[model samples]
Structure formats: C-alpha cells, structure tokens
Target: MSKTALIFWGGWEGHTPARSANIVKEMLAGHGFDITLEQGTSVLTGSDISQFDLIVPMVTMSTIEKPELENLVAAVRGGTGLAGFHGTMGDSFRNETEYQFMVGGQWVSHPGNIIDYRIDIAKPDDPIVAGIGGFAYRSEQYYMHVDPSNEVLATTTFSGEHFETIAGVVMPVVWKRRYGKGRVFYSALGHTADEFDVPQMKTIFERGALWASR
Candidate 1:
C-alpha cells in the first residue's frame, strides 16, 4: 500500500496556506503517497490523526486548541514526520505555546516581505540539498527567530536596496531537527505559489517531504 500523508491547511488567509498545501499535496500524490487534505487544524481529532504517516501543517497564524496541539506534537514525537515551509510550519500558532515548541521556530519578520535575495545551500552532500545551488529568488527574505538546536541545512544572507546595515547577516532558510522517532524538515522559501514552483525550491520542498515521512 502507498504511504499516507495528512495535510492540514488553514489559518490567516494572508499567508496563502491553502494554495501552498495543495501544491505539496499534489506533489506527494504524484510520488505514490496517499494524501488527505484538511482546511484547518481544528478538524484533526486524535483518532483522525493516527491513520497517517506524516502530518503537514500549512497553517500560518491562529490559535490551535490545546488538545489538538498536543495531539499534533505527540503524533510527530511518536514517529510521524512533519514538514512544511515558511510560517505554515515555523511562524505559526501565535498564541499556542506548545505548537511553537513542536515546530521549533517562528518567523519574527521579513524586512521587505517580497524582494529578490540569494539562498545558499550549505551542506551539499545532504540528500535534501545535495545538488541544490545558490539561487536567486523574488520573494520575502524571512527574518526568523529560530531554535538553536536545529541542524541548519541552507541559509540566506540579507541584503537589499531598501535598507542599510541589514546586509551580511546569514540566517537559516532550511533546517531539520529530530523529535523522538520522527524527523522534521522546514524550508523558509515558498512565500508565494510561484516561489514554491521554482526548480530549486521544488526540489527542496519535494525531497524534504519524502525525507520527513516515516
């Protein structure tokens, strides 16, 4: 049987969570994985969650119920892989403390929301980013306050024509961290549908999802 993947997407509409989640769900389906898509995290009951191999949160912002949040954290820690991009995974759950701990990072700011920037692949031999290159992107260069324990996979240095003294700062744009028996992968790309469709971005996102699964 094909592997099962659950995609929970909903929150503030500003981040375009539904669109991002659909892109990933379609890609995973193409890879022969059975995929389920949900509009919001509220629909995930504990029993409803136990049937999948992976849990993907395409949520951007909002309060997640404590029970739902615990179920999600437990699901991943108990061996279900979790992966997604931008605030959908990292900068999510503005009021849920446990949710933030489960994902391990949060988006603090993106100086100019959408502009061009360079993302450098730091670990070339890592399966997810092995052949990925330094690519130029036209999207938000995220300024995130991340967990120090995360294994940084790729980074983007901040520089732009709109500001001064914001140059030469390298922050993680992609990373992974272990939680119990599961694996978590996060990419800071995908600020827009077109951004997620970039060749390099698609490779990173697709490979990350496959790698994060149990």
Candidate 2:
C-alpha cells in the first residue's frame, strides 16, 4: 500500500528547507509515498494530518503557534510517523519542550562548524543502519542534548580540536525513538541539501525515513 506524507518546510533560509523538502519529497515518492509539500507550519491546521502516514517538518528555529503545535503533537501521538534530518528537525522549536520531547533531541552546538569527521555505526544489526559501514564525512559534527531513551544507530567522536572542553565526547549522529504510537527518526547529517550527495548519508536517511514510517 502507498503511504501518504505531509512535508512542511521553510523557517531559516540558511537551512535551505525548500531544497530539503523537495529532496525528501522525491526520495519518498520513489518509495511509493503520496507526498504533499507546503511552506510554513500553517499546513498542519489546514490539513487532516491524521490521514497521512508520515509527517516531515523541515522547518528550523521557527516558532509554531499553540494551536498548530498542539495539532501536530496530537496527530503524531495518534500514530502519524515523524522524520527529518539536521537542524530542520533537531534544532527546531527551541522554546517548545514538548516538541523536543517528541523529537528525542535538540541541537546544542556543532563543535566544529564544517569539518571532516567520521561516523561510527553503533547498531549494525538494526534495519535502519544494517549493512552500512562507518565512513569519512564532512559536515557539522552536531553536539546535542539528547533523550537517553533514544535507540542510537550512529555516533561521532569529538577530538577537542574545535571545542577543547568536550574532547573525546561521543555524540549521536542518527537515532530513532517512539513518540506515543508514532515512530520518530532523526539524523544530524544533511546540513544542506548538498550533503545528500554522499551515498552513505543519503542511504542512512532514506532507510531511516522508511523505518520511521513503519
């Protein structure tokens, strides 16, 4: 059966959310998802969110109103899966604790803005990450405040080169968790749509998105 998705994008321009939303829209469409792309969070209230099997929010650092926010939270709690990557998901809604709780993590810093790093596959057996090996990566090495209950799939180590205080710190790069009855997945990869050019990065996110919608 084909699944449906609602992808609402555009918050901070630096995130290039429009490009991100279009990219994921294509990716999911190829996987048999019926996608609806919209700008701004207002789409949440305008649409019957519960009918969609998945919801992808590509908005970063944006304020969502109480009604819109509550509507989204309610829809997901009733089993609409949520999934996204990088700041679009992790760094979104700084003031909403409930949103962060549902996401399982919030971005704190990227120690080294954009540098070469390596990702370690923590759960090689998990379907979302299985068969994918750790590879050299170039992106913001995200250091986040994460939910301890998350099922971490991948991680990165801080060398103290950028932020000396947190040297040797291991941070999650990809994770998935349950939000009520909905499956939630997030990755600190894809700082911009360009990052998807990396096969490993793209594969991880695509597979993870499918898993999230499960």
Candidate 3:
C-alpha cells in the first residue's frame, strides 16, 4: 500500500505555517507519499488520522481545542509517525503544558535571527545526518529546551556572532524521540520558507521524516 502523510497548518501568521506545510507536502509527494493538507487544528478530529502513515503539525502559537489535541496525540501514540520543524513543533504553545510534553522541546529564545552559526551533524553515521556536509547558513540560531531522554542527532556551536559570547552553548538542531509506540523527529531549522528550501535542511527533513516513520 502507498504511504500516506497528513499535514495540518495554521496558528500565528508570523511564522507562515501554510507555506511551511506546502514545502513539506511537496517534498513528501516527490517521495511517493499521498499527502493530505488541512488548514486548522479543527481538522484533527476526523477518523482519517488512522489511515495516515505520518502526521505533520505546522501550528505555532495557539491553544488547541482539547478534543482535537487529544485525537492528534492518540494518532501519534498509536504508531503514526510525527515530524516537524522549529517552533511549529517545539517552542510553541505559549503556556500549554501538554503540548510541550508531546513535542519534547520548547524554544526559549533566539537572541539574534540568522547571526551566523554552525550546526555540527552529530550523528554522522545515521542516515539522516550522514553524508550531510556541514554548512553554515544565515538563519535563526534557536536556543531550545530539549527533553533529556531524546536522541540528539545534530547540534549547533555558538559562532560568536550575536548571542554566542554570552550564551556559550551547544544547542540541539535535530533530534528523535519515542512517544508510546510511535517515532518522533524534529529539526530546529526552518525559520523561514527559504531556510526550509536549503539543500542540507531539506535533506535533513526528508530523511528525518522517513526515519521517524519507520
């Protein structure tokens, strides 16, 4: 059977959630996955989730309705893969406690957007990170609050540009976690559509999603 992917996008307009979802849908389609795109959290209800092989949430700054949120959680924990990027996955939910737990991280700050930083592909032997030549890009250097048990796949070193001097830290750029029987993968890149289109970032996302789905 052909694999299926579901994507729900919308929340705060500042992050351009729709554009992000489109990029993901296009990528997944190219790889032979049937894609379903929804615009709001309300769509999380239908029974169609069980038919999907993966779930991608692009929501970034809104309190999800409990029923809808629970359905999404159930879909994921029931073995449907979950994949997303940056605030759309983590660092979202202004104060929603459960949402943070599900995503496994929170974006605390980004002192300066695109201030020059270097992400080291930590899991160079892993298919997702392997062969990805380390490259520097001008984008938000995300400072994330990561879950302790997650398998960190990549990290970024402080480049001494804007916040590096004071906030000397190696932050997680890519990671994977297990939620019940399902797999979850997140990439802390994609601050913009252009960033999502970058060759390295696209490779990381595509590979990560395929890995998470397994």
Best by TM-score: 2
Q: Cα lDDT of all candidates, in order?
A: 0.83, 0.92, 0.83
Assess candidate 2 and give its lDDT: 0.92
Per-model root-mean-square deviation over C-alphas: 1.6, 0.9, 1.7
lDDT of 3: 0.83
The segments of candidate 3 whose C-alpha lies over 4 angstroms from its true place after superposition are 159-166
lDDT per residue for candidate 3 within 77-191, as digits (tens), equals 8898999998888755667766667777888878776577778878889888899867887788888788888888899876556654655678888998898878899999888
What 10-residue stretch in candidate 1 is worst by lDDT? Answer: 43-52
The TM-scores, one per candidate, come to: 0.94, 0.98, 0.93
> How well is each residue in 78-185 modelled by candidate 2, as lDDT tens digits?
899999999999988999999999999999998769999999999999988888889999988999999999999999999999989998999999999999999999
What candidate 1 gets wrong by more than 4 Å, as runs, is: 46-48, 160-165
Global CA lDDT computed for model 1: 0.83
Best-to-worst ranking by TM-score:
2, 1, 3
lDDT of 2 at 84: 91
